[model samples]
Target: MKNQEIAKILYEIADLLEIEGVEFKPRAYRKAAQNIESLSVDIEELYKKGQLEKIPGVGKSIAEKIKEYLETGKVRKLEELREKIPVDIESLSAVEGLGPKMIKVLYEKLGVKNLDDLERVAKQRRIRRLKGFGEKLEKKILEGIEIARQRQHRFLLGFVLPEANAIMEELKPYVEKISLAGSIRRRKETIGDVDILAVSSQPEKVMDIFTSMKRVEKVLAKGITKSSVRLHGGIQVDLRIVGKESFGSALQYFTGSKEHNIEVRKIAIKLGYKLNEYGLFKGFERIAGRDEKEVYKALGMQWIPPELRENRGEVEAALNKSLPKIVEYDEVKGDLQMHTKWSDGANTIEEMVIEAKKLGHKFIAITDHVGSLKIAGGMDEEKVMEQAKEIEKLRERFDDIYIFHGIEANIMKDGSLDVSNSLLKQVDVVLASVHSAFRMEEKDDSPRNKSDRK
Candidate 1:
């Protein structure tokens, strides 16, 4: 059990004590609960080692309760409390900004013991009629309810990527260029949704196609420059169509961390222009004609890379006209880390090599697991040499491709590589990873013992 879990048990115990008319003891438990909730240290571990009394207000009684929860999976006082109340305590407590005392009053007087009942009473305006709840409190509650609904408005990026790609592919014929913009373009691990910018002379045809798309559950809004749709998977897709000349500028605007764009605007002001999603404007006149090249040129700098546009120091760097050349995915000559079926991957080494060749990669590595990962069918030294010989044979057959023989070796204890160095020289690359000892010492500042036990 974690400290938070122990704290929660104590909080409920305090609530039950309050109802039972127990005096300062309940207050003491409540104080201990509050302290434990904020504690960074694990209370259950402390309790095991007889250190729980160190926390202020946590006496012998509370320390015993915490220890009971850790060993027996139940605290006696908490169980008794739950039995007496017979209420959905956690559910009632989840109401925005409402704590235990308020929950007790609501449950005792109005019979509003759960979220659904509370929501119903609030919607009916009866909650404001209760003591300690006035017109202002009711308005805040309704606003909180509205916020809860809005929280569901966004979608996960993993869920949205494929749909966005499908839509972009569908529009490719009509548009001169199509770019996936927004958070997806910026490579956010989780995204609210997707934004796509397209350049098309045939705007009406593009709009018609977009509106008639089968995957779009409903068209939220449609305008000249922009159109938004709620997809079948419950993600919103926003599309903007601009002229071919204005496409780059439009892309820069839509592919924004809004804060980053604000800084971009400030930089544009420092130069002699204004930046917008449409294009760069120069004081009641258009400059750069229609290209984003003109936008960077007007700012007296090389093209600002999108990934660096987080406003940290990119703005200052652009003003000074000094930015490092960022590496692109295409620039990576080979993929060093990957899996194959010789260990645990679904594909064979040859299939992975073929795929790499299709990507026009310079080299491909077939680095499967070695014997510390028995579950992955990790090979021993004999199997390692056999795989190496097989790779050499494949290299001769595939003359056009440079197939690098490699192994993703596991790290053994005593801080050493799994495979012998003589065997290591046969491969072009070595990828080291840990399949064990992860939980004990993988933290940013976790201690590692260097002395060999063996």
Candidate 2:
């Protein structure tokens, strides 16, 4: 079948699955459509070669449909589905909590095939007074219609992150692996959030957790094709499920800032290759790449880190193979400054050490505010010495880590260190900083002549 024809079929299937309340299945079709759309290969050639299955998310059933499309001009299954459903699929699908099955019911029983008809029924109090739906459900459905119309264009990221994390955590017990992608993963800070890609042997249970998140907010859209909700913080989150094989590609595609992927595409084009969210494509074929590394290696480039992927210089660097070594979390060996309850911090000297140990740190200095500022509960010399004694005691408890007694000594107006040399020498580290002198004039720090000070 032509790609558009397949896309239409997939869209219909997705709609039906949503109305039918089958979670994850809709994502399979959507992913299929996405994969096919991103292909650089001639669809006709792939169909003839029976290589459609090589595409992520295109399983045996979809492949057969493609073959049938190649043999004939139209898809029988799609035609049958179209005939079975009313012409106003989009309108009927807009009603919240109503999917294909509900659509069928609305069409057959109520003669309602669109939002206008559904709204009229709702206003007439007919649906509210129906067997299963009450006044509350009808109100919810009406609210859903408004939301569907207003947010029909874009998603917001501020809302999507928490819902994604909650769903991922819920599915953790059932699946060994799951990841959130789309704008949220891109660290866009604000997002038109996309679906959470979860992989598991027990996909049914994983999908159940997704629908279960409905209680946290309200289910705005639900289908076997896709499920979306307005989470507690007014965030709309979508969750997609695919087999383990498709997880890598789907995650990459969904998590993309399209501009960055366009850069990847440029690289692919230069190297006589094609790249998409699914995997690296080489002239109508999927190259073997189960992960992002493989995808880049297939394109003859180093792995492109996510942070450097604002589409700025990524493509140029990739082609030249001169990408800078971006810092990773593991490379941080020490925290230069932190606080303790001896000053105004949350933890005590002992408790802070425990916290640092949990983070796998080698050393941490308790640079408490001392004497200069009253707001931070700055300590005097006696209190600093008392804190030092506590630190010495805690030192015996930990042999693998170093705990330093230090102070964030204030910088005076003349650019001099606040603490005297006697106290400064007693500590393992010193971090002199200006807490209140932010407006001070810049100073040149070459050794001044003693005669100038006099």
Candidate 3:
């Protein structure tokens, strides 16, 4: 938790530095932030051991900032930056059409410090009067703000999953059984909140532990069987404690894509068993409730993985015993695509390989971002060749794993590859992806003809 907090401060410092047009330091700060966030162990533990600089990207300068934050609950540099700028860079950056440069301009020219100020300026037609921001840009800004407003609070699972796992780990010793429920368990792309289910004899004690955790920013509610707290990052997590007999059913009940649960309940009704969070019952006689598989078995279907429970064909497939054999976590052997410090990834190529090896991956690829995605720290042809040398050295040291050297080249707005065909021939693999000019019309999404290019 302290790791994430310190990393957030570093990231904000980087953003503030960029807005101030500082040279070189913003990228350095961002790199340090990435390394901090990627650390497998607690940064505070490292601090206690006086080994903060042991982290990949933490140099003497960045290490000092981390120390200040850990010792004082805040960094003085970031506080100074915030006071000087007095603008909410992080929140404003979320608004489309509002990049760092644009944000700086808005702050200086119109005194726009936040999303509301930007909206107010755009609506009043004052933004169009700015030298470069014409009526077209102003119109787009309004639309982007509306879109951002509707979806501002939703967080990507990649960012929230670690926190969820950490919280569960903390409560493991106190609860009889515990699990992450809701869309988080379903592996949904965007999560509005986190739901945790547990079987605990001491419900009140568990709730107290949950609401009192250091990562918890505020305890929204406290109850004997249920409680909710807003984490430091603004994700509200709800804890539900049920009877041991209801543990499995409660998990199934809360780990839903709503529509999926409704379909399962319908199947239970047809099978002459009533189903709910408590258990599957026949005329009030509890039958299957202690295990999730038993509930599915009573409904005459396979137990679907939470990720596949989206009310798709999974229902019918489960019933017919044709449910696809999803790859077990251990069954996976290779990681085909990943980034390193060459791009926006937090770790170096060797560090990534070492961690992947720990995860039992037999093979992996170093597909760092390249060509035209500078915001992601993309590399050029020269840098790509330089990284290949490092990867080759790593291959010699680690003989057990196959390391595929590759590049995640960006797809241009015209749907053309960013890396030259000549340069592409040098790599073992090439992964193409879209990074810019998104939200284009369907017809423009495909590659254009060579003759159409200017």
Candidate 4:
């Protein structure tokens, strides 16, 4: 579980390097950090096997650094970089529209080393007098700073899910049934904290194990029915143990949007029944609770998926028995976007194809980066043509899946693609995306915009 701990240090190193105006190395560090963070295997185990270099985007030097940290619990280079920069760059850089280059400029010009410093300078109207900043940009920076301050404690769903799943897996043996609830279950883009509910006859044992998890940095509370702990990454998690008969009702009550719960409660009242975490009751008799479907059946509605319980007409849909079917992972046939060593990806084309086939995919597209995105080592027309030939040869070896040659073309400032139209037309798939001009507020009236508008 040192994966996240190592990733955090790598990200901090990337920020320090960016602040120092070092080019290329920051992107490499960040890519390695991302791959490591997403790894399913324990990093400590990988280090033990001396296989850290086998990780995609990780090279000899980076692997050595990982080993150094694993062995000694410190990284010399990162500490030196931290001493040189000497600021909380990650927090400052998190503000919307604030990139490393702009951060460097602010730091050198106005001594803006953190959010507070930046906010103070913006309020004083000193930022507008800088070379490229204006009154409008200054106003936007202040707004972004305020938003960042408000959301500072929240973590991305993608970042926190792995830790949550790990904790649940460890607790599985002690509970009859367990499920994640709260924002994590609702699939929110950002989560304030984690909530877990379990059906267990042994609440005391479960609570003890929950509060003493390996990742727990602090045990906030430990009680008979519920326990709360803060993880190493500052994510607070609460675990509740309930009777098996009431598990479904408890899950529905906890996995909620406030608005959705209010609407459901109104429905319960209308039906002459009372509903709570314990169970659904009709005339003081417990009617349903063992399953979520039963609870919904008692309310004269279809069971709703957790993702759709946001008070966005889901209640009405359930009443009409017309809730949409949510797509499951098994329903996916292929992946449209992927990369290989031809661009910035960690694996080779053949390696990626083999893995895709193992995943039961019927098809895959290798959409590597192309043209002028120097940090990604984007391919030019000649290199892309070379890659196409290589992919053609590799196609001869695979019979189970259809492999498409693709490119993620960079959209230039003038609304033209980085790759020529002739080359683009030859590919099976093309992905056009914006990588710069993040601060531009005005919408383009170009043909691309017109088509999208229509």
Q: Candidate 1 residues 1-454, lDDT tens each?
A: 2555566688778767766677887788877887776565667567667888998778888888877877777888777777767666655554466666666776777777656677787888887888987877776666665554444455556556766887888999998889898888877766787888888888888877887797777999887778998775457888888877678787778788788889878878877788886678788676653666567667676677777767788767876878877888788787767677677665667777777877777788887888688778787878878888878887887777788777888876555787888778867788888786653544432225553233
Error of 4 at 444 (Å): 4.8
- Across 1-454, the per-residue lDDT of candidate 2 in tens digits comes to 1454465567777776665577988878877876675454666788778688987779998888777766775678777766666546765566567767756666666778767787888788777666666888777777777766655544445434544675677768877567777767876655665567766776666666676763345777665435677654345678776655556666666667688877777878887876665566778788843676677777777777766667898767876899999766677667869887677665567877887887878998889988677667788788888888988888889977798889878876566776778888888888887776454434433345323663
* Cα displacement (Å) at residue 325, model 2: 5.2
Shift in Å, residue 317, candidate 4: 1.3
Clashing pairs in 4: none
List pairs with backbone clashes in candidate 3.
none
Evaluated with lDDT, which candidate comes out highest? 3
Candidate 3: list runs displaced more than 4 Å.
Answer: 20-24, 54-61, 105-111, 342-346, 370-397, 413-422, 436-449
Q: What's every prediction's RMSD, in angstroms? A: 18.5, 22.2, 3.1, 3.7
- For candidate 4, the per-residue lDDT at 284 reads 80
What lDDT does candidate 4 reach at residue 14? Answer: 90
> Candidate 4 regions off by >4 Å?
20-28, 38-40, 53-65, 71-86, 99-113, 129-136, 438-444, 447-454
lDDT of 4 by residue, 268-342 (tens): 999998999999999889899888788988899999999999999999999999999998877888999998879
Worst 10 residues of 4 by lDDT: 445-454
Clashing pairs in 1: none
C-alpha RMSD (angstroms) for model 1: 18.5
> Model 3 compared with the native: what TM-score?
0.87
